[model samples]
Target: MRVAVVQVGYGDAEPVPERVERVAALVRAQAGHDLVVLPELWAPGGFAYREWQDRAEPVDGPVGQAMSAAARDAGVVLHAGSIIERPGGGEVGPDGHGLWNTSLVYGPDGGLLAAYRKVHRFGFGAGEPKLLDAGEDVVVVDLPLRDGGSVRAGLSTCYDLRFPELYRRQVDAGATLFVVPAAWPAARVRHWTLLAHARAVEDQCVVVACNTAGTHAGTEMGGHSQVVSAAGEALAMAGADEQVLSVDVDLDAVAAWREQFPVLRDRRL
Candidate 1:
């Protein structure tokens, strides 16, 4: 599968609408890629605590609309990244936070394929934990490939990368591809890279980690968007900038590696 990982950045100076336009143009440019991924909360600003509520919108809102059109125009499946979703229904979380940090996926036809609400809120007492409700469902979707078949993809947001069991669950659910959209900061870049490799090797699956770049609200984002093969080899990686790292992954290799090692089958659980 051909994947295009778009590492984007935006600070307090750029307007949200303008940022959306810039990202949409990038997505539209990946016409031949089977899948296109983006970083989390690029529009609402990942670390911009003050802007979350004001920038929150539904899945079909302007940002989603722009991404849908972009996916359709480019003729590729697009992982539009996580958005600050201000959904209705009056539902509340454990901390009384009603909003959700949601990840959205669009098909080649510009249709909404899946929406994964982040189950693991990042902040301990502030930020996401205080402002957003925790997601309950584990989301997995079949991303349609341009060549006719589909790839089973498991979805998880930024903080979820630290949890290996979550990815083990994806592996059990028949997911050969794990898509992690993160807004990880520069301070923890080592953890981001190490954990990504660990997950790929442990789960024996393709790991596509798309991280944010540039400074947002005085916070520096770690921008090493990468694709790791089933053997934990880095297929492609990007630098700390607004760039796209495209790589080709062989899904069949995942099965081959698992069969050769056969470690997963020995699980007592």
Candidate 2:
């Protein structure tokens, strides 16, 4: 499967509306790619905590609509990064906050394929934990390939990479491809790449990690967006700047690697 990982870079000076339009255009540019992935919270900004509340929208809000159209125009399965979701009807989380850091995927026909609310909130007591609800369910969706076949993709966000159990559960659910969107900071960028390789090696799944770039709200985003094979091979990796890493991934290799290694079957835990 051909994939395009768009590593987006934005700053505080750029308005959210212009950024949204820019990202949508970027998605539209990857016309022949089977899958196009974006970074986490690229719309509302990752460390722009103060802006999230004002930028929050529903599932089918402006960001979603723009992504849907972009996917349709590009004819690719688009992982349209993430958005700050404030659903209507006054729905609130256990913490009394109705906001959610939600990721969205769209089909070639501009249809909503899947939406995964980030389960592990990054901040311990402040940012996410204090302002957004933790997602309770794990999301796995079937992604279409160019060969008229499909691959089961497990969805997780930035901080979710630290927890192995979440991916273990996804592996149990028959996921072979792991889609991870991150806005990891430059300070711990090493951890970001290392953890991605670890997840792919351990789970024996294709890891498509899209991360953000540039400084925003005083935090520099780590921009090494990458794609790792089931065998932990870094097929493609971008730099610490805005880039689009396009590479072809063999989905069939997952099963072959699992059969060859058979490590997962020996797990006793």
Candidate 3:
């Protein structure tokens, strides 16, 4: 599968609407890729906590609309990074934070394929924990391939990358590819690269991680968006700037590697 990972940057200077328009164009530019991914909270600044509540919108809001159209135009299954979502009709979840950091996936036909709310909230009682409700679902969707076959892809965002159990559950659900969109900071970027490869090695699945770049809200985003093969080899990686890392991945390689190693068969617990 040919994948395009868009490493976007969010700054205080650019207006949100303009950023949306620019990013939509970027998505449209990846016409031949089978799958395209964007970084988390590119529309709403990742560290701009003060602006999240004001900018929150529903799944069908402007961001989703533009992404759906862009996905159709590009003719690729697009992971439109994440958005700050406010549930419509005044509904509320368990935490009652009134908002969620949600990742959206769109099909080639611009149809809504899946929406994964981030299960792990960051900020340790601040930021996400204080402002947003936690997601309860483990999301996995089948990505349609050019050859008429499909690959099961598990969805998680940002801080969820640190939790191995969540990915293990996805592996149990028959996911061969893990799609992660993060807004990880530059301070802990070393952990980001290490954990991405670790997830691929431990789960024996291909890991596609897309992260942001540039500074927003005084925080520098880590932009080493990468693709790791089932064998934990880094197939492609982007620099700490706004760029795109396009790589061709073999979906069948996951099955082949797992069968050859047969490590998962020995799991007792």
Candidate lDDT values, in order: 0.91, 0.95, 0.95
Model 2 Cα lDDT, one tens digit per residue, 1-269: 99999999999999999999999999999999999999999989999998888999998999999999999999999999899999989988777789999999999999999999999999989888988998889999999877799889999999999999999999999999999999999999999999999999999999999999999999988899999999999999999999999999988899999999999999998
Instruction: Give per-model TM-scores.
Output: 0.98, 0.99, 0.99
Candidate 2 at 184: error in angstroms? 0.3
Q: After superposition, how far is residue 148 of candidate 3 from its true place, in Å?
A: 1.2
Off by over 4 Å in 3: none
lDDT of 3 at 22: 100
Model 2 is weakest, by summed lDDT over 10 consecutive residues, at 90-99
User: What's the lDDT for residue 47 in model 2?
Assistant: 93
CA RMSD of each candidate after superposition: 1.0, 0.7, 0.6
Candidate 1 local lDDT, 1-269, one digit each (tens): 99999999778899999999999999999999999999999999899889888998888999999999999999999999989987667666676777889999999999999999998988887788888889988888999998899999999998999888888888878899999999999999989998999999988889999999999888999898899998999999889888899899999898899899988888897
Candidate 1 backbone collisions, by pair: none
